[model samples]
Target: MAGTFGNCGALSFFLTGYLQRNPNASAAEVVRYLDAKCQGQPDQSKRQHPQIRARYALNGPLRL
Candidate 1:
């Protein structure tokens, strides 16, 4: 069995499909879109990994 982030390639597949659908969107745009999509959830609907990825993608690679 797979864990939350290791689910049978579904996450990667979904992300690829989503990016394909929004071909013109930038990485920041994708992050914002994902944030907006989760806006109705509790705790302001924020995600940890995506935010970290956005930081690296938009700002640059991490130091460590």
Candidate 2:
């Protein structure tokens, strides 16, 4: 809970929620977008992934 790896569930939840709201969104947009949305919760983001960091961009550092 102090790094960007152990929060798979939260990441998936966030992405899923975002995608539900935005059906055919871009990866970069999603990631960056999510990053901004969660910026206020730095503590929860302790286990954030690279893809989450980069807004889900496959071209970015995707955890998958």
Candidate 3:
């Protein structure tokens, strides 16, 4: 998985679990949750950086 997806694998795995738990989550909410999980509490010792760094350009909340 790491060889194929690199750091994105971790992000995808986490996001998958999050979506499974919050099936009604919106796009904005998903981004916020990912940001908080990946960036807000980073592991400095491992040199971890956020995989998600941009926001979507949608006119309204995009539900997923």
Candidate 4:
């Protein structure tokens, strides 16, 4: 997951799988989940990429 930046296909694939497992997930939850899965490891070497970021227009959780 180190070089996942700028790769839309990989991001889509990962998101699809996560959504399948958590169909009721909100937009913010999805962002956090992806960030942890891709870059939350204790080993810095495993997280070569920056943190995942997303913006949503809503005051509360945006359910997908």
Clash pairs, candidate 2, are 31-55, 31-56, 32-55
TM-score of each: 0.37, 0.46, 0.50, 0.46
**lDDT leader:** 2
Instruction: Flag the better candidate by lDDT, 2 or 3.
Output: 2
User: Best-fitting candidate, measured by TM-score?
Assistant: 3
Compose the digit string of candidate 1's lDDT tens values, residues 1-64. Answer: 1012444232344456679999988988876665554444322222235544455442421121
Candidate 4 local Cα displacement, residue 25, angstroms: 0.4
Q: Count the backbone clashes (under 3 Å) in each candidate.
A: 0, 3, 0, 0
For candidate 4, write residues 1-64 as lDDT tens digits. Answer: 4224355434466788899999999999999887766554333333334343233222322222
Q: CA lDDT of each candidate?
A: 0.45, 0.58, 0.54, 0.55
- Residues 1-64 of candidate 3: C-alpha lDDT, one tens digit per residue: 1111454544576688899999999999998887776553334332323333223222322222
Clashing pairs in 4: none
Question: Candidate 2: RMSD over Cα atoms?
Answer: 8.7
Q: Against the hidden true structure, what lDDT does model 1 obtain? A: 0.45
Question: 1-64 in candidate 2: lDDT tens per residue?
Answer: 1234344555566777789999999998897977775555546435546556466432322232
Name the better of 1 and 4 by TM-score: 4
For candidate 1, the per-residue lDDT at 6 reads 40
Q: What CA root-mean-square deviation does each model show from the true structure?
A: 9.8, 8.7, 9.4, 9.2
Clash tally for model 2 = 3
Poorly placed runs, candidate 3 (over 4 Å) = 1-8, 40-64
Tally clashes: model 3: 0
TM-score of candidate 3 on Cα atoms, chains taken together = 0.50
